[model samples]
Target: MNITLKFLLLAIFSGVVHLDTMVFGQFMFSRPIVVGPIVGYFFNSPQTGLMIGVILELMYISVIPIGIKIPPDATAATILSVVFANIRECNDLGMPMSIFFGIIFSLVYKFTDIQIRTLNNMYLSWVDTAKAEFVEKRINLLVYYGIVVSFLRTILFYLIVLPIIYFIVKNVCVLIQYCPVKENFRDIIYILPAIGVGIGIAHFMEE
Candidate 1:
C-alpha cells in the first residue's frame, strides 16, 4: 500500500471517528469494534487490532468516565498506536505498546480537559451575545452556535492534537516499550480481564 494513501485514509478515519457527544460518548470510540479494530483494519492488520482491542477492552472495561474523572482516551491512542506499530514492524509487542501509549494519551486528555470546558464556555458566551443581538431569533442563534462549536471542536482537536499524537506514536513508541514498568504492565494485561469480568458479574447481580 502506498504510504500516502494509507495516511490519508487513516487521517480521514481519525477525523470523523474521534468526535464525542453525549450519545456517542456511551459507545463508538469506547468499543473495540468502532475505534481499535476499525483502525487496525486500515493498518492491514484487523486481527492484530482485534486481539489488541480485546485485551484493552477488558483492561478498561471497568474504568468509566463518571463525572469529572477523566479516563484514558483509549480510542485516540489505539488508532495511532496500531498504525505506528504496523508501520514500524513492532508486531511482537505492538499491542502492548499501543496500550502503553493509550495511558499517555489519557493523561493528555486529563491535562487538557479544563481547556475544553473553557472553550465550551467561550462558545456559550458567543451564543449569549447573539441572543442579546437578536432576541426574536434566539433559536437560530443557538443553532448556529451549536453547529459552529461542534465542527470547530472536532476539527481543531484533529488539526492540533492528532498530528502530535501520531508523531509521538511513530517516533517515541520504541522508547515507551523499553520502560522499566514494561514487565509489570504485561501483568496488567493478564489481570485486567479478570477485573473486567468481575465488574460485569457484579453489575449483573445488582440488576
Candidate 2:
C-alpha cells in the first residue's frame, strides 16, 4: 500500500478507536497490544507492530480511566510509533527510537484529549439549548456534531504529528549512518519487551 493511503487508513482507524472511548463502542480495539500489530500489518511488519504493542501494553497496563480523569492516549501512541518505525524501515534497530517518540506523542494526545472533552462539553451545552427550544432535530444534530468533532480531533492530530515525526526520524537515520553505534544496540531493543513484561507482572501482583 502507498504510504499516504496507509496513513489515511491509520487515521481513520485511530478515529474509530477514539470514538470507541465514549461515543459508540467500548471495545478494546484502542488497546496498544491490539492496535500495534494491526498498524504494523498495514505496513507489512506485524512483528514490529507486535513488539511495540507489547512494550506499550505492559508499560501502561496499570493506568485506568476513572470518570473525567483521562489516561494517556495509548492508541495514538501505538499508531504513531508503528507508522514511524515502518517509514524509517527500522527492522534491525527494532524501532526503539520510534517507541520513544510514540510515548511522547501519547503525552501530547492527553492534552488534546482534554481540549476535545472541553469541546464535547460545549456541544452538550448546545444540546441542552436545543432541548429547551423543543427541537428534536437540533438536539440530534448537536449530538452528531459532537461525534464528528471527536473524529476530526484524531485526523488533525495525524496531520500535525506525522510530518514532524517523519522529519525527525529521517534526520536521525542520516546521523546514525555517520556515528558508529555499538553492535548491541539491536539487542537493547529486544530487551525492552522483557522489561515491559516484568513491569506488567509487577503491576498485576500489586493489584
Candidate 3:
C-alpha cells in the first residue's frame, strides 16, 4: 500500500477508535492489543503488531478510567508503533525502540485527550445553549453534532501528527540502524517484553 494511503486509512481507524471511547459502543477495538495487529496486518507485519500489542497490553493492563483519570492513549501508541516498525523494516533491534517511541507518543496523546475532552465540554455547552433556544426535536441534532465533532477531533489529530511522527521516526531509525553499538542494543530489546510482562503480573497482583 502507498504510504499516504496507509496513513489515511490508519488515521480513519484511529479516529473511529477515539470516537469509540464515548460516542459509540465501548468496544474493545480501542485497545492496543486489538488495534495493533489490525494496523500491523495492513502493513503486512502482523507479527510486529502482535509483539508491540502484547508488550503494551501487558504494560497497561492495570489501567482503569475511573472518575476523571484518563489513561494514556494506547490505541495511538499501537498504531504509531506498527506504522513505524513497517516503515523502518524493524527487526528485534528496532522493535523495542519503536515501542519506546510509541510509549512516548501515548504520553503526548494524553494531552491530546485532555484537549479533546475540553472540546467535548464545549460541545456540551453548545448543547445547553441550543436546549434553551430550541424545541425537544432539535436536542437530538445537537447531540449528533457533538458526536461528529468528537470524531473529527481524532481525525484532525491523526492527520496533523502522523506526518510529523513519520518524518522523525524515519530519520531516527536511519541513525540508529547505522550506529556501531546496535548489536548490543538488540540485547536490550530482548528484555523489554519480559519487563512488560513482569509489570503486568505485578499490577494484577496488586489489583
Candidate 4:
C-alpha cells in the first residue's frame, strides 16, 4: 500500500468513527461489529476482520457508554487489530498481540476522550452564557467547533500512536519468528470468541 494512502485511510476511519460518537449521533457505527468488517474489507482480509470484530464486540458488550460514563474507545482498536493481524510479515504473530495492543490502546484513549469532553465543556459554557439573541449562533459555532476539534484530536492521536504500536508489534513478531508457537497462534483467534462470551456473561452475572 502507498504510504500516503495508508495514512489517509487511517485518518479517514478514525475521524469519522470518533466524530460519530463525539459530535452528535449516538449511532452504533463506532462499534467493533461494524468497524471490524469494514476494516477487514479495506485491508484485504474480510474474514479476519469479521472474526476480530465479532470477538471484540462480544468482549465490549458489557461496557456501556451511559450518562457520565465514557467507555474505552473501540473504533481504533478494531481497525488496528484487523489491519495489523492481516499484515503479511507478522503472519500469525499479528493476530493475538495486535488485538491485545489494540485493546490497551482503547483503554489509554479513554483518558484522552475524557479530556476531549472536558474541553468541549468550554463550548457548552459558551452556549450557556451567550446573550439570548446570539445563543443560536453560539450553539451552531460550538457544534462545528466540537466536530472539528474532536476530529483533529483523533487524527493527532493516530499519528502519534500508530508508529509506536506498529514498531512494537513488528519487533515482537520477530521475537516470535522462530518459535513453533507462531504457527499455533491462529488457534488463539478461534479461541478468543469463547473467552469473550465468558467475559460478557461473567460481567453481567457479577453486576
Candidate 5:
C-alpha cells in the first residue's frame, strides 16, 4: 500500500477509535465485545479482530478502574495493537503480538492522565476568565484549547510510537516466532490472560 494511504487510513482509524475511547473511556472500546471486532472490521479482518478481542476480553474481564486497581487502559491497548499491526505489515491476527505493544503505549498515557488533571487545574485557575467567556458566548477558546491539546497528545503518540512498534514486531517478533518452543510460548501467552480472569473472579468472590 502507498505510504500516504496507509498513514491516512491509520490516522482516520485512530481518530475514530480515539474519539470512541474518549467518549466511552474504558467502558466500551476497551472490551472485546466492542474494540476487537470493531478494529478488525476497520482493517477488513473481522475474524482476526474477533479472535484477538475474545482473548483480550476474557483476559481483562475483572479489570477495575476504581480504587487501587488502576488497570491499564484497554482502549489505548486495542488502538495501539491495530496501529502496530498495520505499521508492521503483520497478518490479521496481529493482536497476539500488538497487544503487548499496546501495553507499552499505555504507559505513556499514565502521564496523560496527569496532564489532564493539570489541564483541569489550569482551567480552574481561569475560573474568572471562564465566567467572563461564558457570559460573552466565547466558547471557541475553550474548545480550541481542548482540541489542540488532545490532538497534540495523540499525534505525539502516533509519531513516537508507530515506528517503534513496527520495527520491534517485525524484527524481534519474527525472531521469537522461529524459536524452538514457540508453541509453548504461545500457550504461556494465552495462560496469563486466563490467570488474570481467574484472579479477578477470585477477588470478586471474596468481596
Candidate 6:
C-alpha cells in the first residue's frame, strides 16, 4: 500500500473507532481489545496489536466514561501503542516504550477531546435556543453535525500526532539502544500485564 494511502486509512479508522465511544452506541468497538488488533492487522502486526490491546484493556478496565466526566483515552493509547511498535522507524523502540508513549499520548489526547466536547456543548446550547416550531429539526441537525465534527476532529488530531510522536519515539529508541537498562525493558513489558491485572481486580474488590 502507498504510504500516503496508508496514513489516510489509519486516519479514517481512528475517526470511525472514536464514534463507538459515544457518537454511536458504546459497543466497545473502540475498546483496546478490539481496536488494538484491528489497527495492528492493518499494519500487518496482529500479534503486536493484541498484546498491546490486552494490556491496555486490563490497565483501563475501570475507566468507564460517565456523564460529563472525562475518562483516560484507552482507545488512543492502544491504537498508538500498536502503531508505534509496528512502525518501520520505531521497530527498535520496543513494545514497552511504545506502550509508554501510547499511555502518555492518551493523556495528552484528552485535551483535544475536551476541546471538542466544549465546542459541541457550545453548539448544543445554541440548538436549545432555536425557535420552538423547528427546534426538533434543528436538534436533529445538530446531532448529525456533532457526529461529523467529532469524526473529523479525531482524524485531524491523528494526522497531527502520528508523525510527531513517531519522530520522538524513534529518536528515543536510538538514544536508549546502548543503555544497559534497555536490555531489561522487555522484562518490564512482561511484568506490566500482571500489574495491570492487579489494578483491574482491585477495582472490583469489596471493601
- What is the descending TM-score order? 6, 4, 2, 3, 5, 1
Give the local distance difference test score of model 5: 0.61
Estimate the TM-score of every prediction.
0.66, 0.88, 0.87, 0.91, 0.73, 0.93
Model 5, 95-164: lDDT tens per residue?
A: 5677777777767765675576466556644546566647444455655566666655665666566666
User: How far does residue 153 in candidate 3 sit from its true spot (Å)?
Assistant: 1.6
Kindly list the per-residue Cα lDDT of model 1 for residues 1-207, writing each as its tens digit.
876566666655654565453213445554654577788877678876776676666656665778877676666556655665574734355555656676576566545545665665654554456746565476666665655554455445544655565566555556656677665554544554576577667766873
Off by over 4 Å in 5: 22-32, 67-71, 83-95, 129-144, 188-193
Better of 2 and 4 by TM-score: 4
Worst 10 residues of 1 by lDDT: 18-27
Best by TM-score: 6
Model 4 per-residue lDDT tens digits across residues 1-207: 874578677866778887776576869888889989888888778888888899899988888778998888778788778867866678866878889899988777788888988887666777677789999888778778878888888888877777778788888888888887677776888888998899888988993
* Whole-model lDDT values for every prediction: 0.59, 0.79, 0.77, 0.81, 0.61, 0.85
Q: Order of all candidates by lDDT, from best down to worst?
A: 6, 4, 2, 3, 5, 1
Which has the higher lDDT value, candidate number 3 or candidate number 4? 4
**Per-residue lDDT of candidate 2, residues 1-207 (tens digit):** 766776677788788787876677779888889999988888888998998998888888878899879988888888888888875544465387788888898889899889877866665655565645567877778778878988988888887788788778766755665557735676777788787778778888993
lDDT of 5 at 17: 60
lDDT of 6 by residue, 6-106 (tens): 77789899999999987899898999999999998998889888989989999999887788899989999988888888766545456888899989988
Ten-residue region with minimum lDDT total, candidate 2: 85-94
Once all C-alphas are superposed, what RMSD does model 3 give against the true structure?
A: 2.3
Model 2 residue 23 lDDT score = 71
* Candidate 4 accuracy as lDDT: 0.81
Which wins on lDDT, candidate 3 or candidate 5?
3
Instruction: Give the Cα error of residue 4 in candidate 3, in Å.
Output: 1.5
